[model samples]
Target: MAEFRCRACGQEGTWVYDPERYTCPACGSIDVHFVVFRHELPDDDPAAKRMDELATEEANKRPKKESED
Candidate 1:
Protein backbone atom coordinates (compact mmCIF):
# COMPACT_ATOMS: atom_id res chain seq x y z
CA MET A 1 0.00 0.00 0.00
CA ALA A 2 1.10 3.55 -0.75
CA GLU A 3 0.20 6.96 0.58
CA PHE A 4 -0.92 9.96 -1.43
CA ARG A 5 -1.51 13.61 -0.57
CA CYS A 6 -4.10 15.81 -2.18
CA ARG A 7 -2.57 19.03 -3.38
CA ALA A 8 -5.80 20.93 -2.96
CA CYS A 9 -6.99 19.83 0.46
CA GLY A 10 -3.71 18.43 1.76
CA GLN A 11 -5.54 15.37 3.08
CA GLU A 12 -3.43 12.23 3.09
CA GLY A 13 -4.77 8.78 2.31
CA THR A 14 -3.87 5.43 0.85
CA TRP A 15 -3.45 4.98 -2.88
CA VAL A 16 -6.02 3.01 -4.78
CA TYR A 17 -5.09 0.65 -7.64
CA ASP A 18 -7.09 1.82 -10.59
CA PRO A 19 -6.15 1.17 -14.20
CA GLU A 20 -8.23 4.04 -15.52
CA ARG A 21 -7.40 7.08 -13.46
CA TYR A 22 -6.14 8.26 -10.09
CA THR A 23 -8.29 10.89 -8.42
CA CYS A 24 -7.98 12.52 -5.02
CA PRO A 25 -10.85 12.30 -2.58
CA ALA A 26 -9.90 15.23 -0.37
CA CYS A 27 -10.42 17.90 -2.98
CA GLY A 28 -11.70 15.86 -5.91
CA SER A 29 -8.58 16.80 -7.78
CA ILE A 30 -6.74 14.65 -10.28
CA ASP A 31 -3.43 16.42 -9.77
CA VAL A 32 -2.35 14.01 -7.06
CA HIS A 33 1.01 12.27 -7.03
CA PHE A 34 2.24 9.13 -5.38
CA VAL A 35 4.27 9.47 -2.18
CA VAL A 36 6.34 6.37 -2.63
CA PHE A 37 8.05 4.45 0.19
CA ARG A 38 6.59 6.61 2.90
CA HIS A 39 5.28 3.93 5.19
CA GLU A 40 4.52 0.23 5.41
CA LEU A 41 1.01 -0.97 6.32
CA PRO A 42 0.14 -4.07 8.23
CA ASP A 43 -2.01 -6.82 6.73
CA ASP A 44 -4.96 -5.73 8.87
CA ASP A 45 -4.78 -2.00 8.45
CA PRO A 46 -7.95 0.11 8.56
CA ALA A 47 -7.26 1.67 5.19
CA ALA A 48 -6.92 -1.75 3.62
CA LYS A 49 -10.15 -2.81 5.29
CA ARG A 50 -11.91 0.29 3.98
CA MET A 51 -10.56 -0.40 0.49
CA ASP A 52 -11.94 -3.93 0.62
CA GLU A 53 -15.30 -2.61 1.74
CA LEU A 54 -15.43 -0.04 -1.01
CA ALA A 55 -14.48 -2.61 -3.63
CA THR A 56 -17.21 -4.93 -2.48
CA GLU A 57 -19.76 -2.13 -2.44
CA GLU A 58 -18.78 -1.02 -5.94
CA ALA A 59 -19.04 -4.58 -7.24
CA ASN A 60 -22.49 -4.92 -5.75
CA LYS A 61 -23.58 -1.57 -7.12
CA ARG A 62 -22.86 -2.48 -10.76
CA PRO A 63 -26.01 -2.29 -12.85
CA LYS A 64 -27.11 -5.44 -14.66
CA LYS A 65 -28.52 -3.80 -17.73
CA GLU A 66 -28.57 -6.77 -20.08
CA SER A 67 -28.53 -10.55 -19.93
CA GLU A 68 -26.66 -11.74 -23.08
CA ASP A 69 -27.42 -9.05 -25.64
Candidate 2:
Protein backbone atom coordinates (compact mmCIF):
# COMPACT_ATOMS: atom_id res chain seq x y z
CA MET A 1 0.00 0.00 0.00
CA ALA A 2 1.09 3.55 -0.68
CA GLU A 3 0.41 6.61 1.43
CA PHE A 4 -1.86 9.19 -0.18
CA ARG A 5 -3.41 12.57 0.49
CA CYS A 6 -6.01 14.31 -1.60
CA ARG A 7 -4.92 17.77 -2.59
CA ALA A 8 -8.47 18.98 -3.01
CA CYS A 9 -9.95 17.88 0.33
CA GLY A 10 -6.76 17.31 2.34
CA GLN A 11 -7.76 13.72 3.05
CA GLU A 12 -4.74 11.57 3.91
CA GLY A 13 -4.51 7.76 4.05
CA THR A 14 -2.98 4.62 2.66
CA TRP A 15 -4.19 3.21 -0.65
CA VAL A 16 -4.08 -0.31 -1.98
CA TYR A 17 -2.26 -1.35 -5.14
CA ASP A 18 -2.75 0.88 -8.15
CA PRO A 19 -6.18 0.48 -9.70
CA GLU A 20 -7.90 1.97 -12.74
CA ARG A 21 -9.18 4.71 -10.44
CA TYR A 22 -7.04 6.20 -7.66
CA THR A 23 -9.58 8.28 -5.87
CA CYS A 24 -10.01 9.73 -2.41
CA PRO A 25 -12.25 7.69 -0.12
CA ALA A 26 -13.39 10.81 1.69
CA CYS A 27 -14.51 12.93 -1.29
CA GLY A 28 -13.88 10.77 -4.37
CA SER A 29 -11.57 13.44 -5.67
CA ILE A 30 -8.80 12.52 -8.14
CA ASP A 31 -6.26 14.79 -6.48
CA VAL A 32 -4.86 11.89 -4.45
CA HIS A 33 -1.09 11.53 -4.45
CA PHE A 34 1.56 9.45 -2.74
CA VAL A 35 2.95 11.01 0.43
CA VAL A 36 6.46 9.90 -0.48
CA PHE A 37 6.63 12.31 -3.37
CA ARG A 38 5.26 15.19 -1.35
CA HIS A 39 8.62 16.85 -1.70
CA GLU A 40 7.81 17.29 -5.34
CA LEU A 41 4.71 19.29 -4.60
CA PRO A 42 4.59 22.95 -5.65
CA ASP A 43 6.90 25.32 -3.77
CA ASP A 44 3.95 27.00 -2.16
CA ASP A 45 2.66 23.73 -0.69
CA PRO A 46 3.17 23.30 3.05
CA ALA A 47 4.50 19.81 2.74
CA ALA A 48 6.90 20.79 0.00
CA LYS A 49 8.10 23.72 2.09
CA ARG A 50 8.75 21.47 5.07
CA MET A 51 10.72 19.06 2.92
CA ASP A 52 12.87 21.95 1.75
CA GLU A 53 13.58 22.97 5.32
CA LEU A 54 14.55 19.44 6.30
CA ALA A 55 16.81 19.15 3.28
CA THR A 56 18.51 22.38 4.20
CA GLU A 57 19.05 21.17 7.74
CA GLU A 58 20.63 17.97 6.53
CA ALA A 59 22.87 19.76 4.09
CA ASN A 60 24.01 22.18 6.78
CA LYS A 61 24.81 19.32 9.13
CA ARG A 62 27.22 17.71 6.71
CA PRO A 63 29.92 18.64 4.22
CA LYS A 64 28.56 19.59 0.84
CA LYS A 65 28.22 16.48 -1.29
CA GLU A 66 28.75 16.33 -4.99
CA SER A 67 25.71 16.96 -7.13
CA GLU A 68 23.78 13.86 -8.15
CA ASP A 69 23.80 15.14 -11.70
Candidate 3:
Protein backbone atom coordinates (compact mmCIF):
# COMPACT_ATOMS: atom_id res chain seq x y z
CA MET A 1 0.00 0.00 0.00
CA ALA A 2 3.05 2.25 -0.16
CA GLU A 3 3.43 2.54 -3.89
CA PHE A 4 4.06 6.26 -4.02
CA ARG A 5 5.99 8.87 -5.94
CA CYS A 6 7.73 12.04 -4.79
CA ARG A 7 7.04 15.06 -6.93
CA ALA A 8 9.67 17.01 -5.03
CA CYS A 9 12.54 14.67 -5.75
CA GLY A 10 11.16 12.09 -8.12
CA GLN A 11 11.89 9.33 -5.63
CA GLU A 12 9.70 6.32 -6.29
CA GLY A 13 9.63 3.06 -4.36
CA THR A 14 7.74 1.12 -1.72
CA TRP A 15 10.16 2.13 1.01
CA VAL A 16 9.88 5.82 0.17
CA TYR A 17 6.29 5.84 1.33
CA ASP A 18 5.51 7.68 4.54
CA PRO A 19 2.44 6.55 6.42
CA GLU A 20 2.23 9.47 8.84
CA ARG A 21 1.33 12.13 6.27
CA TYR A 22 2.25 10.51 2.98
CA THR A 23 5.36 12.62 2.79
CA CYS A 24 8.45 11.70 0.89
CA PRO A 25 11.05 9.92 2.97
CA ALA A 26 13.80 11.01 0.64
CA CYS A 27 12.82 14.66 0.34
CA GLY A 28 10.37 15.12 3.22
CA SER A 29 7.94 16.72 0.80
CA ILE A 30 4.21 16.26 1.11
CA ASP A 31 3.86 16.59 -2.63
CA VAL A 32 3.71 12.84 -2.88
CA HIS A 33 0.85 10.80 -4.26
CA PHE A 34 0.05 7.15 -4.68
CA VAL A 35 0.21 5.58 -8.09
CA VAL A 36 -1.33 2.41 -9.41
CA PHE A 37 0.43 -0.63 -7.98
CA ARG A 38 1.69 -3.05 -10.56
CA HIS A 39 2.20 -6.65 -9.61
CA GLU A 40 3.73 -7.55 -12.93
CA LEU A 41 4.57 -5.79 -16.16
CA PRO A 42 6.07 -6.80 -19.47
CA ASP A 43 9.85 -6.75 -19.84
CA ASP A 44 9.54 -3.82 -22.23
CA ASP A 45 7.25 -1.80 -20.01
CA PRO A 46 8.80 1.62 -19.56
CA ALA A 47 7.12 2.13 -16.23
CA ALA A 48 8.57 -1.08 -14.87
CA LYS A 49 12.02 -0.15 -16.05
CA ARG A 50 11.76 3.29 -14.48
CA MET A 51 10.64 1.80 -11.20
CA ASP A 52 13.55 -0.60 -11.19
CA GLU A 53 15.97 2.20 -11.88
CA LEU A 54 14.61 4.32 -9.07
CA ALA A 55 14.71 1.37 -6.66
CA THR A 56 18.32 0.71 -7.51
CA GLU A 57 19.23 4.36 -7.01
CA GLU A 58 17.49 4.46 -3.65
CA ALA A 59 19.22 1.27 -2.59
CA ASN A 60 22.60 2.71 -3.48
CA LYS A 61 21.97 5.82 -1.38
CA ARG A 62 21.80 3.78 1.83
CA PRO A 63 24.86 3.27 3.94
CA LYS A 64 26.55 -0.06 3.42
CA LYS A 65 26.80 -2.47 6.30
CA GLU A 66 29.60 -4.97 6.49
CA SER A 67 27.23 -7.55 7.95
CA GLU A 68 23.64 -7.37 9.06
CA ASP A 69 23.40 -10.82 10.57
Candidate 4:
Protein backbone atom coordinates (compact mmCIF):
# COMPACT_ATOMS: atom_id res chain seq x y z
CA MET A 1 0.00 0.00 0.00
CA ALA A 2 1.07 3.58 -0.63
CA GLU A 3 0.71 6.52 1.76
CA PHE A 4 -0.91 9.77 0.67
CA ARG A 5 -1.53 13.25 2.02
CA CYS A 6 -4.69 15.21 1.42
CA ARG A 7 -3.91 18.64 0.10
CA ALA A 8 -7.08 19.91 1.70
CA CYS A 9 -6.55 18.95 5.33
CA GLY A 10 -2.93 17.81 5.29
CA GLN A 11 -4.13 14.50 6.68
CA GLU A 12 -2.11 11.42 5.76
CA GLY A 13 -3.39 7.97 4.82
CA THR A 14 -2.58 4.74 3.05
CA TRP A 15 -4.10 3.48 -0.21
CA VAL A 16 -4.00 0.17 -1.98
CA TYR A 17 -3.93 2.08 -5.24
CA ASP A 18 -3.23 5.58 -6.50
CA PRO A 19 -5.42 8.17 -4.75
CA GLU A 20 -4.95 10.92 -7.29
CA ARG A 21 -8.68 11.18 -7.95
CA TYR A 22 -9.75 10.36 -4.41
CA THR A 23 -11.37 13.01 -2.23
CA CYS A 24 -9.97 14.20 1.08
CA PRO A 25 -11.90 13.15 4.14
CA ALA A 26 -11.20 16.09 6.42
CA CYS A 27 -12.01 18.87 3.95
CA GLY A 28 -13.74 17.06 1.07
CA SER A 29 -11.10 17.97 -1.48
CA ILE A 30 -9.89 15.79 -4.38
CA ASP A 31 -6.39 17.16 -4.12
CA VAL A 32 -4.92 14.03 -2.54
CA HIS A 33 -1.35 13.10 -3.40
CA PHE A 34 0.80 9.99 -2.86
CA VAL A 35 3.58 10.25 -0.28
CA VAL A 36 5.60 7.04 0.25
CA PHE A 37 5.52 3.34 1.20
CA ARG A 38 7.03 0.51 3.28
CA HIS A 39 9.37 -1.86 1.48
CA GLU A 40 10.74 -3.96 4.36
CA LEU A 41 9.47 -5.29 7.65
CA PRO A 42 12.35 -3.86 9.65
CA ASP A 43 11.68 -0.54 8.02
CA ASP A 44 8.10 -0.50 9.23
CA ASP A 45 7.38 3.07 10.20
CA PRO A 46 4.97 3.83 13.02
CA ALA A 47 3.74 7.05 11.43
CA ALA A 48 2.60 5.20 8.33
CA LYS A 49 0.68 2.68 10.39
CA ARG A 50 -0.82 5.45 12.48
CA MET A 51 -1.97 7.24 9.36
CA ASP A 52 -3.56 4.07 8.04
CA GLU A 53 -5.34 3.44 11.30
CA LEU A 54 -6.50 7.02 11.58
CA ALA A 55 -7.76 6.96 8.02
CA THR A 56 -9.78 3.81 8.61
CA GLU A 57 -11.10 5.12 11.88
CA GLU A 58 -12.04 8.46 10.41
CA ALA A 59 -13.65 6.84 7.41
CA ASN A 60 -15.79 4.72 9.69
CA LYS A 61 -16.76 7.70 11.82
CA ARG A 62 -17.95 9.94 8.98
CA PRO A 63 -20.30 9.70 6.03
CA LYS A 64 -18.67 9.26 2.66
CA LYS A 65 -17.92 12.75 1.45
CA GLU A 66 -18.87 13.30 -2.16
CA SER A 67 -16.35 14.51 -4.69
CA GLU A 68 -16.56 18.14 -5.61
CA ASP A 69 -17.72 18.90 -9.14
- Residue 68 of model 3 has an lDDT of 89
| Candidate numbers, best lDDT first, in rank order | 2, 3, 1, 4
RMSD of 2: 10.0
Task: Rate residue 2 of model 1 by lDDT.
Answer: 59
Candidate 2 per-residue lDDT over residues 4-69, each given as its tens digit: 878999978776534344577678888777644653356776666888899899989998768867
Which candidate ranks first by lDDT, i.e. highest? 2
TM-score of every candidate: 0.39, 0.41, 0.40, 0.33
State in Å the error of residue 3, model 2.
3.8
List ranges where model 2 is wrong by over 4 Å: 1-34, 64-69
Query: Residues 18-58, candidate 4, lDDT per residue (tens digit)?
Result: 32335654566878776544342122456557767787899
What are the RMSDs of all candidates, in order?
9.8, 10.0, 10.7, 13.5
In model 1, which residue pairs have backbone atoms overlapping below 3 Å?
none
What's the distance in Å from true for residue 55, model 4? 32
Ranking by TM-score: 2, 3, 1, 4
lDDT per residue (tens digit) for residues 2-69 in model 3: 57689899988776322245577678798987763444455456666888898899999998999989
Better of 3 and 4 by TM-score: 3
Query: Which candidate, 1 or 2, would have the higher TM-score against the true structure?
Result: 2
Worst 10 residues of 2 by lDDT: 13-22
> What range of 10 consecutive residues in model 1 has the weakest lDDT sum?
34-43
Question: lDDT tens digits, residues 10-31, model 1?
Answer: 8887865443446775677887
